[model samples]
Target: MSNYVIQADQQLLDALRAHYEGALSDRLPAGALFAVKRPDVVITAYRSGKVLFQGKAAEQEAAKWISGASASNETADHQPSALAAHQLGSLSAIGSDEVGTGDYFGPIVVAAAYVDRPHIAKIAALGVKDSKQLNDEAIKRIAPAIMETVPHAVTVLDNPQYNRWQRSGMPQTKMKALLHNRTLVKLVDAIAPAEPEAIIIDEFLKRDSYFRYLSDEDRIIRERVHCLPKAESVHVSVAAASIIARYVFLEEMEQLSRAVGLLLPKGAGAIVDEAAARIIRARGEEMLETCAKLHFANTKKALAIAKRRK
Candidate 1:
């Protein structure tokens, strides 16, 4: 699919909005500019003059609004392998990515998926993009399809375990590398493909810093490791990993919410803090440890709120 991000004036944005007014559907809720959904494309327009166009006809659609076409298109490129993975002469690759590390209420989930050449078309047709752009329902729908066909492994660090790991003084980067490497290796071992071409990691750190995190660990597959940012846009495997990770994270959040009998919102925002405070008021601080990452600063605010209620 052809996609582009363009900076346009309000006039241009208004023009497009009016063009798609009736066909313009509400999708993602941004502050000012709404996501106007058309039959073939999804547009995220911001009042700040940033507009993103994504879908098969993204370029054509955006051309109707913008004067100059932005040449930056991620369609032809696959994640972690844009050039390096292709150099390997085959699309048989494993890509690793994670989700929910920044969330206040869910587990940190990492997933690795092996995308064989034969399944490339299949994966593309699944409309696998970065997990951030996808809604919970879309992710939940696509994840199982990827899981059923693609060889994959997912590792989840629940809140309690995440807190314990943090107390052990391991940085999140190191922990991510640990899980990503292990999951990729496990997926590779499970499939045991005939010399899979490349193994890519969604680069969380700089090229050197990422390796530095893995320097102490011998588990990393240094070979064919393409550490790329926003790899999900390019590599189906990374996108698949992102989706599956999100699905699992959402599932964990659902279970945690059920256990607490409250809706646990994502992110470390003020709203999340309010929810945390409510949880603590009902259950003791001990129960918060089970449902949330205790190391976050939100814990302190929730404790204060709990004390205030007392």
Candidate 2:
């Protein structure tokens, strides 16, 4: 069997041991490279190709033989998952997420978080995950915590501005994709001095379409942008971004509601229609466009209902 040497931070090494010991994934992939946890030092190892052993016996054997005589203190800034995998050397990883896309009101906000070989656990422990899986209060509480742990950037596209752009001939989907890409670009630019190795985005479209759209804008992502579904669950940085985006959107919505003197509802559903109608009655139809995304079908419906009641 061929052997390979892999280096990793202590937490990742401990995670590797936990995975092999059935405390993590039940089936450890063959040829897995991982770190083993010791009191003051971490031991790194590689398993021979994708073989699933019956139990933890092989892991124990490998752990015992792989022990090195020299031990060093764990680096304070080492994060396991953010570390570049074996063949990649050291590289930075980033995660991106957006909010307010489906809402009839409020601005579309996209956020990106840069995570390196340190601070992954602190983010995960703060309950950062998919924003859809969280409530507004929870997101608000966790967003600042995530920001404290990692550097991030955001882009907000307010409704009136978005409508003006759309009326000028931008397709809704294209506009959204463009805004998301621009946000990504801004984040990349902000972190360019650091030169991260890769970036991850929650995939909004098929790969070819996304790449083509980005290419049209002359914003080539250099094949290092990974777009995957449910990425936030697998990547802590993306989860942190998701929380930030959601928190910002929630806050913006609240402010918009106060500005218009009516409770603005979430989403483009029937409840939102009711809220829009109430706002129009309390204020005026002309003011509705300012507080809501006029491009939504719900906007036309609300206008029609308002006219009928008048």
Candidate 3:
């Protein structure tokens, strides 16, 4: 079996725990070790934020944790031609995306953008692309321009609300559907010019499964919905939505850091545990309810550490 070592955080480890739960496992101070659902892969995570992957699918499996990619079913994408200023920007399309869903702290943010023929070329010219490919500083700089140019809406599910949702046993995909559908309707209404000819989604779940999750919602945009993986690679409207959603996520993170008087770091890991312990020691355990998603295993680890501090 091949062995590979790389970085891992608490949240990523938690994901691994969820993914490899049924397999034989061991949790220790050094890290967590488990056999993946596929017996072909065995992985170990370290408290130092490192992960070691061995077995056949090591690289592929490790990437999912590192990238925060959805573990849902994935299908091969028939790549669409790369969009140019004259081609894609010439259509009436609305695009949607979300940010901070994988984070241990902060709210889930969903954003949608409507771009008609007149403004598509403008956004394309601005070089707006996938938010994942761009850094937070880049997003901050580009987001204002999109806000001024596009008709859009952003919905935020802050920590308190997110905690409540989890407590009520809401599944992540269903929550995402609710947010995306809600944002799409609100943004479409905000456009006021015309109904978009099509709504494009940076597909997370399979198309049918995505819609199935929406059954719980009372109102959903009954528009022509087109779901594509990596839609932001060529769709300017989707890219615009991604930028703003990510920008807002960062801004909220900043606000959270300021409130807690510590750089509340992103991702779940050992450092996050330390930060949580700090928050608990300074503000008490209840304060974490406002700052973190209680569902995370990080909460338990941090709480345990907090008790030691007393």
Find the candidate with the highest TM-score and give its number.
Answer: 1
Local distance difference test, per candidate? 0.77, 0.65, 0.76
Write the residue-wise lDDT of candidate 2 on 1-310 in tens digits: 1122334455545655665453333332346564443333333344532222222222222323223322221223121222122212123568888888888988888888887756766676787779899887888788888877788888888878888887898766666677768877787787767766667777676444565666678775544665555667656778888898898888888899889987788889988887777777778877876878787888778877777777
Q: Which 10 consecutive positions of candidate 2 have the poorest summed lDDT?
A: 77-86
Model 1 stretches astray by more than 4 angstroms: 1-90
Model 1: lDDT of residue 45: 78
lDDT winner: 1
Task: Rank the candidate models, highest TM-score first.
Answer: 1, 3, 2
Which regions of candidate 2 fall more than 4 Å away from where they truly are?
1-91, 216-219
The per-prediction CA RMSD against the true structure, in angstroms, equals 12.4, 10.8, 15.2
Clash pairs for candidate 3? 10-268, 10-269, 11-268
Over all chains combined, what TM-score does candidate 1 have?
A: 0.70
What value of lDDT does candidate 3 attain over all alpha carbons? 0.76
Query: What is the C-alpha RMSD, rounded to one decimal, of candidate 1?
Result: 12.4
> Over all chains combined, what TM-score does candidate 3 have?
0.70
Sorted on lDDT, highest at the top, how do the candidates line up?
A: 1, 3, 2
Model 3, range 1-310, lDDT digits (tens) per residue?
Answer: 4454555567767777787778746444344444343577776665666666666555345434544322221223211222222333456889899988778878899999988878888987887998889987899899999999989999998889888888899988888888999999898788766888667888777556677788778887755675666777536899999999999999999999888888888888899898999899998888888878888899899989989888
Supply candidate 3's per-residue lDDT for 154: 94
